[model samples]
Target: CSNKSGNKILYLHFDSLIIFHSITTISKVSVTAGKSVSIPCLYDSRYMNYVKYLCEGYYWNYCNYVVKTNKPDRSGKYSISDDKNQKIFTVTINQLTNKNTDYWCVVEINGGSDHGESFQLSVSSGKNSGGMKWCRLGRNCVTKSSGSIDGTTVTIHTTELNVFTVTMSGLKPEDSGWYWYIQIPVHLTVTEKLINSKYCKRS
Candidate 1:
């Protein structure tokens, strides 16, 4: 097992069969609706000559290519650039909207396995940003304008400039993982609270 650029890899073996699974860190990026955001993707030096591209979709295998180092998007909504010397590529998404969801940074390989890292994108309305939704990846979402989910409450008012908060009451160990507020994604971890035995009274 190893961690690379926020991606966690694990290997499972069943007899002679081996399975590889990866869990990527879903970063939260707050961008106003109709605004633009640039994301940087870093790859191994061995893939310097490989084709770098940006793909959009909730699933890795089904993601559609948005932009590539060789084929720049002509729609002007997406752009990509690569820096071979630094082993990094940058992709810019312009005029973002709620429709923009999950994305993957990928390196193409011929006759071999391709490498990719996935991230989630969240879009916030510049006006009336009070309404927000909380969601787990590939699952249903709870909206502040409607109701809460599993004791999770979202603050209907903006706490600060372009900032909102969500409180998940009675968090359990299973609640820890990737979640999103509208288009913004965050990784949450829940651990058991330890109490000092010295404070306990004998029954």
Candidate 2:
């Protein structure tokens, strides 16, 4: 994962009972439809040799298997790979749709608790609409050149949530507003009607 913000490592904790088990990962992840996303699941060093997999679904009881490290890419859309050296395994999903909105990173353990962490996969609505901008300020984004913002990506921090980042390729001319860290919501207006043309006759 590229750290545009260079924040500290984020640790995800379970409930008080399982607080001992901590998983390192990003708080939130965002991807565009028809695009692919690579999510890094940093596990404890102890799980270096364990089998890793990505499960898909909103609920833990129904999280169906998408891909496993032991299994190669049979579907050509989902894949898993382990980097034992870094104690990290990555899950990549391609051709994501709105349905592909939730997933979990799982590690298999025989006759014991299988460690896992959940995350939300937001399919950007503006990604297809052509307004894209990366969140460089962590929780606050301000642009004064333009009075309004068009396309801005919002990512929820589900884990440690100390630092969250959303990346997009393009920036719109009008996407200038403040992304307040707190209760302030975004205010953007699409301006397809603002086009100026001299072809029409005056009434």
Candidate 3:
């Protein structure tokens, strides 16, 4: 969870069962800006009795970096609450930013090495405000393209060209991904329809 490398191993032992700690459950992996979200995590049933020993390490402002201990405080704009004895840890973050942040839960077995699990908090906004705006070359087109929607929108700017607006409306569960684009324009003046979606891209 904390380590994006995903190369680490965590093990726990309880009641001579040699229980290895693992993440049993998780909540939504991503969320929208200014929206409330929860991260639910659980441990292996064998280690349920020791659930009280679990603690959460939340990345308050950066990517996968823990900024505070397990307690509600003003130190950062976030809160952590859960029933450790029930093996349920819920981390509620407040006022997410454009930056990426992640959270992890760890438990150190008494007199044993610590084992942990983590989840990512995907933060997004209704509409991506920064990106290339496009339109087609035409006069009869609605002639509107200055606002933002939660989903994709296309506009005609030139009679021979096409325009597009990208957005993520009504935020859904399957909209998570890193989108890419490659363009090769055709006819100098053509009747065409364009569609676009807001997304994160890697160069």
Best by lDDT: 1
Decreasing TM-score order of the candidates: 2, 1, 3
lDDT of 3 by residue, 131-158 (tens): 3433221111122444322243333233
User: Residues 23-116, candidate 2, lDDT per residue (tens digit)?
Assistant: 5544455667788877777788878889988888876566788888988679799988887865768788899888888887888776555667
TM-score of 1: 0.52
CA deviation > 4 Å runs, candidate 3: 1-21, 45-71, 84-86, 127-203
lDDT per residue as tens, model 1, 58-132:
766577988889999999999998767645577789998999968887888776556777766667786434347
Per-residue lDDT value at 86 in model 3: 48
Clashes of each: 3, 1, 18
Provide the overall lDDT of each model, using Cα atoms, as 2-decimal numbers: 0.68, 0.59, 0.41
Q: Which of 1 and 3 is the better model by lDDT?
A: 1
Question: Where does the lowest 10-residue lDDT sum fall in candidate 2?
Answer: 129-138
lDDT of 2: 0.59
* Model 3 accuracy (lDDT, Cα): 0.41
**Best candidate, TM-score-wise?**
2
Q: C-alpha displacement of 115 in model 3, angstroms?
A: 1.6
| Candidate 3 or 2, higher lDDT | 2
Off by over 4 Å in 2: 1-20, 128-203
